[model samples]
Target: MYAIPDSRLPLPQVLDRFPAGVPHRRNHVNDYLLVPREVDYFNGFLALLGRAQPPLQTDQLATAARNLNDVAAGDTPSPCIQQRIQHAHLLEQLLQDRDWEPSADISRELKLVVAYLHASRQLIPDTVPGVGHLDLAIVIDTAWPKLAAEVANFVDYQRLRHLEAERQGRSDDAIAFNRSSWLELREIEARLHEHQRRVREGSYAPEPFTYFRVH
Candidate 1:
């Protein structure tokens, strides 16, 4: 079997969807230009994205995100990784939709993005020894900002729900707890947005990476 299939289209056509939010890192790849295999790999992956399957069901995905949160409790994931997780988590919360309901438009958008996130494989398969998540991360990061208002609205809904619960019991300190969670969510959102701003403005960037032929 072919390790990485050749793209149906010419190279330039394949790159059109990429680097939209993924800045061509100031790394060896861009500096030296990409090798033929690397170029073909991207083309192939971009093509496959059109047919990729969902990576996880909503409940399963929520479990995965919660597990990651538990594992990373008190630690940090680099900004790129963190933003990708947060975006997925926010969508998870929306899909759960237990406490807050989104507008029809927001709900559809969240589901679409979440499905994209769940793709078991991508232009770059996650099974790659390293940097497997790069393609997924870049796609989510590109889509992250557009979802901000909905995410913030969901946080607001959570805050109000907890406050209501507090009034009924008015003793569990649910109010305080929810407030803290909201603060944490907003902080992460702010940081992610700032990071995106810097990337777009060309002010700052996370360390660049070498190419892995996108298989």
Candidate 2:
């Protein structure tokens, strides 16, 4: 990745000093720079830090930041600041992994995921319960097939089951699996397309073929 020069403070410290409210746009020379979304992520990080008695782990921080962005974007009803902060920390850790060098395909894919998460967050409300979490997972799953196994294991299967139940008109359960299943399916389809493209380009080999004979 093109190394943006390191910020003056460590990620946590920078987050600590983050200011409140939306950031302003600044023009430098001919370039119009929107305030770095990272600033929002950092502010959200601090907010999360304040709520949790113990500081969150790096991975948690990143996830919270992404969540906060989603809340801010109106994707969710407005996730609590604490949740946003935890997500942010998780994202930061993922981005900082030394294995994600700019030249590597994985690094590029990671950046694409971050950008997608950022854009998605901007598109929805942050407070919307579970929007950030679900959307973030969708982005990761779409962008990184290698991580699919982990995601599959971690996803809320009960929620999916509940969604299926709701679709069948069962309101008795009272569990609101309000997540957008259609969107998740669309994301999965997009990932499949991307995987196919990679295989066609010889960037990645196709997985072993599995055939099922319909009885």
Candidate 3:
């Protein structure tokens, strides 16, 4: 949960896959960071990527996780691994949430990131022992700076939707409220609470002088 500089975020364990001295590691990381700058090229690359390789199959994922059951070897999966998986799903859900529409650039970028996850081959071959899937984390962390706000807003929208459903005496999942209505409700609630707080506190006033004189 601690913050680190973006440049240093690709886990050290993944970088260790390089030999004691090799420029391949540095070049590989740079490609990820820099390629997104050329919008047309990147988009075309993604299109070709989709056509070139089949999506990661369910069996492939199962094979990757089969090692987790080796209790005798004490191979415990990291909680962060599950968190990353959930985060990927969250990004997908955000794109689909009809109430919150994203900017065109954001929509395209999200599709690229999701497509990267679905692709069978990646910058770092998934077959590598320890750092196989770490590249996926690196890609997500790299894109997170641009995506964090939109994701946060989507989360807030979801929270307010559930609250709105409760207020309407409807099931949380059944409510069909939109973001505009939620925003209006939020503003009105905020103003009313502020007014109530001011009323309860009375007007800001100077302290009254004590009538009784001390002997």
Question: In order, what is each prediction's RMSD in angstroms?
Answer: 21.9, 18.8, 9.9
lDDT of 2 at 113: 51
Clashes of 1: 3
- lDDT per residue as tens, model 2, 1-215: 21211221112221223333524232211121223454356335433323222322333334434434543444342334334344333445456533222324355554555555556444223334444343344233234344332223223333353456677777524533323543474467679999999778775555566886778
Best by TM-score: 3
- Model 1 stretches with alpha carbons more than 4 Å out: 1-77, 127-130, 170-215
Question: Which sequence of candidate numbers ranks them by TM-score, best first?
Answer: 3, 1, 2
| The candidate that achieves the highest lDDT relative to the unseen native structure | 3
Clashing pairs in 1: 45-123, 55-118, 55-119
Better candidate by TM-score, 2 or 3: 3
Q: On a 0 to 1 TM-score scale, where does candidate 1 land against the true structure? A: 0.42
Candidate 3 local lDDT, 1-215, one digit each (tens): 21222332223332223233433212232113322233234334534333232222222233223332232123322334434555667888877777667656577667777877788646445444433454465456556656766677677677778788888999866877776766787788789999999978886686688787879
Instruction: Show where candidate 3 strays beyond 4 Å.
Output: 1-80, 124-132, 196-215
Worst 10 residues of 3 by lDDT: 25-34
All candidates' lDDT scores? 0.47, 0.39, 0.53
